[model samples]
Target chain A: MSKYTLREAMAIHASRQIRNEDKVIVGTGMPLVAAIIAKNCHAKDAVMLMEAGPFDSNPLALPSCVADPRGFVGAPWVADPVQMMGMILQQGRIDLGFLGGAQVDKYGNLNSTCLGTYKNANVRLPGSGGASDIGAMAKRNLIIIAHEARRLVEKVDYLTTPGWMLHPYENGKRVKDRLVHRKELGLWGGPEAVVTTMGIMKFEEETKVMYVSEYYADLGVTLEMIKENTGFAIDTSKADQVIPPTEDELYILRNVADPENIFI
Target chain B: MVSESKNSTKKTKIKTLQEAISQIPDGATILFGGWTVTRKPMAAVFEIIRQGKKDLHLVSNPGGPESDLLIGAGLVGISETNFIGHEVLGIPYCFRRAFEKGGLEKTGYLHDDWTVQTGALRILAGAMGIPFIPTKSLKGTEIIDPEHDLLADLRGKSKKLPNKKVEFIQDPFWDEGELLLIPAIKPDYCIIHVPMVGEEGTVRIHGGLFMDFYGALAAKKTIVTTEQITSEDYLKKQPDLNSIPAEFISDIVEVPYGGHPTAVQGMYDLDFEFFNRMVDSTKKEDTYVQWLQEWIKDLPDHDAYLEKLGVKKIFSLRADPGLGYNPRLKRKS
Candidate 1:
């Protein structure tokens, strides 16, 4: 019922979370959309690091698997994709990481590397580019996926990234001990929030459990709809606001992000 | 030298696009001037392919299928470019397959480095009569020396050849006794396609003049093929709109709608059917030759070439008819 497309809504919601001067690591696809939206809406100083080693510079619109000009055409500075991954992302210089997921679980783990299973799958997808580095080193991560039961699953076919997992340790002490690690370190780690067409959801920082926060305005869909689709619990009180893109936000999106087409 | 005089003094009537390409020699360094899908010199490129000029060193911005045609013909000995992937436009599968198969040789630079870093800066350097411009593009990157051996070799034996300091060291205090300045790329010839040109060779481009003037000014010779030819008075009417003045030009050939099979703005839209045909072909040398012969060689002249395109179809597709055909100029009427 929102005026924005599912992709546009996802971008609008993700854009709200980014601070004005945050250094974000952006990948291709939905990540590029979110970064462009953030830059146009609020994050003016958002530096876009492309895989082709250009910072915030737009190249001629050309089709490329990894180094598309759209990724950095409107960015402030461009850097080498490899150097960005190694020196910037891995070094934890990036504040927030925006990514897309093919499959997501209750724990917020995302699977984009494979389909069906790691070794054998019904289909194959483009394997991870810089997602691993961003997921590992970024202090905070936001994931965007279209709301559907098929995408929101109990378990992913393959574990492309380890979100939150149990850690074992041996020690001699009377006091109890619980050692926890974020997913990037090979231990189980999950995302902070997941934005979808139907509603928004966030994982409990302590429990690493996902709960629905808000529904899209007048989305005839209910908490039960999200619960049934996600196979998870719904948190209604946390759903304070579901913001739509403003006129200025929409203008920037149309002009800067998708000039030739209004699809996004 | 004799051929040069003959080409310069006497106006050689080249009947077809293929005839014009036979003039170029082997191993000639060429600078291609145009942005993506616009203002590209398709006629000259086609001619070069038809003549089968071998061991050519081509310099240009990233391109689509046309780049493949040269690589497919085994004419490109060396290519210095920013990017080579297929954009929304079809990929040059031959170029990709050739590179993957280790058949074609190339030296790659970052897209920004090729476009803004080396191209624009090199042009300014040439215009100012400077030797080179210092850039910070490839510093501390994998494209440095051993990783890009071909690029290093292109720099040659001059110790200052692959100067890294010129691009990096921002402060004089940080001088590590070294600097890397990208040498100006002075090509042997430059080729371009334009919307209009006067009999005196003044050129006008419509939108996005991406590094065309830079390539032309840096190169030794400049050749232009235009969609239409107008008079000097008409050209002088829009002096501010002119992209390159006739004084800088070395040769001017009036080949109206010469950008067939490739899109020429205002005159003709892209001949997608022809482009697709080229894409689907088996990509053998003989197949390409046969393909060119079928489309180009059989035509008698420019008028017949236009006739083959079908006047009805050209007019129907013409968003603006006035944009095409200036009879007074003796281009296509």
Candidate 2:
């Protein structure tokens, strides 16, 4: 790859998270771009779903929002929110879910509620639509966020999505010497990986603590730059330079995925 | 789902937009049916603001202009929603300013937030005529924390307000950790905008029925505004295509282009430029005030509002017959 925007890099890495046959639920913005790229470029059999109740939607053009009528163009059928949120998602069938929030912690917990207080909010944000539902119900979730010191906080202002917050349980007993885990609280799957504008971060196997896993060196986003900008201490010992997007990935991504230059 | 209109001799009522909205008094808890620029009853919303109903409670699902515009108008006292923002247009500036500039304590505005699935389950419970619904969502998150319950003050104060925020219980049957028992919410009215409605109250929603059907079924009364009103025989021929029975609807308003700025499928595309303009106006308090007055307050009715939008813009937004959305519409992204 000669050069790519930060968003394109994020999209490429985020697209890699999807498997061929994964039943994916994607929120709007870059995640939608990422899902489209994955469907066309890699995850051919993946089903693209959204909160506005479209299941297995295959759109020809980019929808302005998840519930935009355009997304229903090539779908099997349109559904109500009850069928989507209750029958499908709450039933725990979706495999891979994507979410984005205003702020996130090392535990992958997000806060999309408000900046200050709930009642007397300093800045009221759009609250967790399906971020919590997808986080708790989906088998695995991928979080995409902008990397900044204030946003990459030690603890989010409000916990909208349950992340690795408690220890895992063995036969209904909490395991000792372990960081927070979602399984202990009955959440289906927690954050698997966090793809940021800077790089990709993943949680440790045992501790569930987030650590830098990849970085974009060509964009001058080094491991040190990421660490310095982080609000909390982050591990970068096992970090590696990210493999640039392939020619095929780039072509499909630009032409098919986001022809409008929406996210990228 | 049981309803008062069930097996009743009374036919479903039909009224003008103003008259339908006029029946709803101040302080009524309402659920506006729409999500992210789709199927919002813009005509009813405008009328409510124009009528200046005060201290209203709102139930929302990933709200777009329906929720944000109401909050901007400063009519809503409490808004329970998972999300409130114009998706492509940007942040809900009015909603932000309402809370950020005017704190809940100071401004008398409370925001009770819910996760999307949990919100749906709550509404579903209402539609089912159940008091509460069980859910695995909001388990380990602060959404269910008692301290974050913004409506604590309103708890037990009014019939509409539930006594408790949420009751966490372990699965007694299978013993699968804690399950959140979310309270049911049957709003005073559910205003749903759709493409077609039968004379006897058969609703045919052309697009994604984002909680609108459940909302219609659950509410004490439902007002369905439509782009066109068809005959009962026309809808009954394809009963599967219709959304709900005649008993569920309280009234019908034949408001063409009622879901403007956020129209419906097979009828019109969302007015993205209008959303963009509204979002832009919200940046400044004065501009927002001016914009609201110009578009909502100053306008005599939905017809006038449509007139101000101009015939050219209206025709431009009409969805292509084959496609459910306007193909020629140029998007920002």
Candidate 3:
């Protein structure tokens, strides 16, 4: 196992979420690093798609931005956003999606809009770019964000992106025996994992509530720390130590994927 | 299909940037081409603001400085966009200020996955001379729910928005899947910046075509500003590079460094320092006004704007043709 920065470990963990030949929809920056690492390591043929409208892009270098020219370097088909999102993603062709959010809730709801109410905002973050669509439409979503109490809240200030929904009965049961997927609300599956700097979170099968599934042993994290840092109650029964990234995985990320450490 | 094989003769006339933009009047709806922080026709945007055009409805897949500057200047009456934020720099301060101050009106839904694609489909429908097109994007989302008045109703009622936001119905063919019918959007004028344009008005867009071709075709008229203007014969040799044929375009203007602060592929990198400075100043209304005075009002035209940018700074932003990014920005990590 390779010793790595928290960010690098997060990237590795996020990469592990992807599977071989998965039709992955990706956001920018860290997701880009993770996807590239996945392609280099195990999921070699994972079809990388960007919301900016490129498919099967074999970029010469890590794209500086979502709209970066590197995306078109060896891309097979360059399409419009309509073709990318409407015809492909909204058509339910995507297998996995990688996203980032400012704040996420126990129900996996995401907030990238204003911090306060819509009419009055203390701090207005950038609203959803393509997160709402990816979250609402992709088969499964994997969220990567810095772990902090402020970010992992009990309930997001605004539900910019829907996750596991609040069906009335689920709230009463304290466990979602009647847990509804986003598809029940006529959307796609909600988030499956929340990869953080400290650990990886997965939704409980029955309740659809998030809990720490894997803790970073190298970070010296404890179940108490995860609980204290989280705004809501968390399930630690299924939690276990996550295996660190292999040296080869670390080398590919550092030397090939991101030599500048721009995202790593 | 017939339009593609016509005479192949250039029909649109070339004009100065001023003369070309002078055609746009107040209350006109304009669609812009380019995505966030890349290939935006900032030169045309600055000119529109400098000309003091008002109440103009603007449309883009999702624009950056071009939309934010116009909204901040209080020139745009309504803007239909997917998302408007400085990509890595966070939300644009001016855009937020415009909405917070009630200076600009906004329509359309959030997220590029729907908004840009829907906007492009609207453009495509217009290009095909259709009234509306059916789409599968907005079935589950609230934007098409009709209950969401902001997105569904639009600003009161006007000829500008003649059709409903979306009409949900069962797919008649299969009688199973649900679909939404969206109305077409034909802007009065469309403005875009390209890497190069032949003398005959064939636009060669380097990098990604973020619905620029659709935006150009979907509008009543299109004005192109390019980094370089080459001969028709030069473009004829390589027909694949010609994304926008001359027939759809109305006017072509050669404006070097037309997409400043943003970027033009193979020409320059994004002026991060300049955008950062603008963001810092535009954090508050007072300083934002000051920034406008220095960057917009004080400058006579795009030429003066370039002059204000200085030769050294412009040169520093220039990217090597081979590398696609400025070599000056080397970070040893």
Candidate 4:
């Protein structure tokens, strides 16, 4: 297998999180790319929901946005945004939600609201569209973000989406604990994985603090590089080198999922 | 109860696009109907720019060309947006530029459930004459956080409006539960482009009804532009197809290819090349002004705008009847 772009690797890694029966609520860009790839390959029966109110849409081409005209093609049920989010999502019917953020903390908390202050931001990002809802309610959520020191911060400026609120330190080392559940906060679900350009990261089941799971070895991305780019201390003790994308996966993604190579 | 007038007494007010849009007073709160580049009321938005309307407050859930053009023209004062982007084409360059430059004032909410859905719920509440609607999505997020002053700052800048931007309350019945309540929004006017509008004011929207259905109801008045304005009898044949009732609409204009640059599902495809050009032109300040001069200022009206787009480009975007999208359009992988 040859080397792949980080975007392609991220999409491929993100697709691995989808299961055959998972009802996925997808956002735009790479999440759509990853979902299409998963649908065409492993998670063929996965129910996909678009925020613009379509269920089980089978478009010939990838939809550019949630409400892209293509999303309406051969859709099983077309609903209003309220019905999709308020009725379906808020009801906790969605199983998986794929989201992205401008910044993510060690606890997997996301910040897409603003850079400095909400009112006066040094760099005002496009705020969470449905990320908060998805992050708060999807039974399991996957986040896709580029690897950078500032992006993977120790603490986010604002908690746009709840990650793990309980981060207790013992002897300056994180302890294994689940202090607050989404259910406790009147929200459901939480971050499951963080797929980045370099590798995949997951939270310690008990601690809910993110740790490197698999580093992409084929791309020559080292654990040291990952640590250097991360704002917080990341545990790579049990991390393994990820196998490169198989030829079959690359062929399917390039030819079928992202024929436009929009994300790749 | 006074018996509602049932006769053809319901007037189908017809106005030129300019005249219809001129009714939107300066600084009036407005809402636009469309998602992304599809079905955006480009012709009417262009008219607003040409008329030099100023200090307008736009409430678009997930906006596109309409809001972008308004901000670019400096006509908008405050904008409540969830996602102001061109989708695959990328974020709205002018909007981002204006926003970052402080040339535009803005507030955003979560799109997944809070932003667009909340907007829809707000509109539904407004249509039903409700004070506010309870939502569970914005809770546990910064949107409901009192410390977040993104919206509060803008509220201070604007004139005294009737409704509070957002409010939080502990659920009276539930022991440990709370909810976010967004006040109902009734826009002074809402302009939307549709595939067809009946001569009697019925609107037939192709593809997903999206927020257009609610936006029409949530506004005090609705102005509709369509690819074709068929006879009232034609629309009456298929009552199920009618999305917006005649009574809610104030005026209807027949404007072919009015959703150009954007799309009119089953009629044409999004002009990707045009979007690319807009993105490129808006990358720099001087070039954006030049692009605007060529497209908006120079072109007198919708006809002129279409004429400037040229027959070849327009024909290329035309969707095949069976496919509902341009068959000739190709995306490079």
Best by lDDT: 2
lDDT digits (tens) for residues A71-104 of candidate 1: 3233455453334553565456667777776877
Instruction: State the DockQ of every prediction.
Output: 0.05, 0.57, 0.34, 0.38
Instruction: Categorize the docking of model 3.
Output: acceptable
Per-residue lDDT over B23-82 for candidate 4, one digit per residue giving the tens place of the 0 to 100 score: 878987777887778888888887888888988878776777787767766677667666
TM-score list, all predictions: 0.55, 0.95, 0.88, 0.91
* lDDT measured at residue B250 in model 3 versus the true structure, 0 to 100: 85
For candidate 2, write residues A1-264 as lDDT tens digits: 557888888999999999999999999888888999899887999999998978888888888779888788888877777778777887888998899988889888888887776666677888888888888888898999988888888888777887888443343333445555577677778789999889999999987788999988868898889988899999999999998888888888889888877666
Ranking by DockQ: 2, 4, 3, 1
RMSD of each: 12.4, 3.8, 4.7, 4.8
Please report how far candidate 2 places residue B122 from its true position, in Å: 0.9
Task: Point out the worst 10-residue segment of candidate 3 chain A by lDDT.
Answer: A167-176
**Alpha-carbon deviation at B268 in model 4, angstroms:** 0.9
Over the stretch A204-256, how does candidate 4's per-residue lDDT look in tens digits?
Answer: 98777899999888888999999999999999997999877888778878998
Evaluate residue A221 in candidate 4 and report its C-alpha lDDT on the 0 to 100 scale: 91
TM-score result, candidate 1 = 0.55
Ranking by TM-score: 2, 4, 3, 1
Best of the two (1, 3) by TM-score: 3
In angstroms, what RMSD does candidate 1 have relative to the true structure? 12.4
Candidate 3 displacement at residue A109 in angstroms: 3.0
Off by over 4 Å in 3: A1-3, A166-180, A185-189, B1-12, B100-114, B139-148, B151-156, B327-333
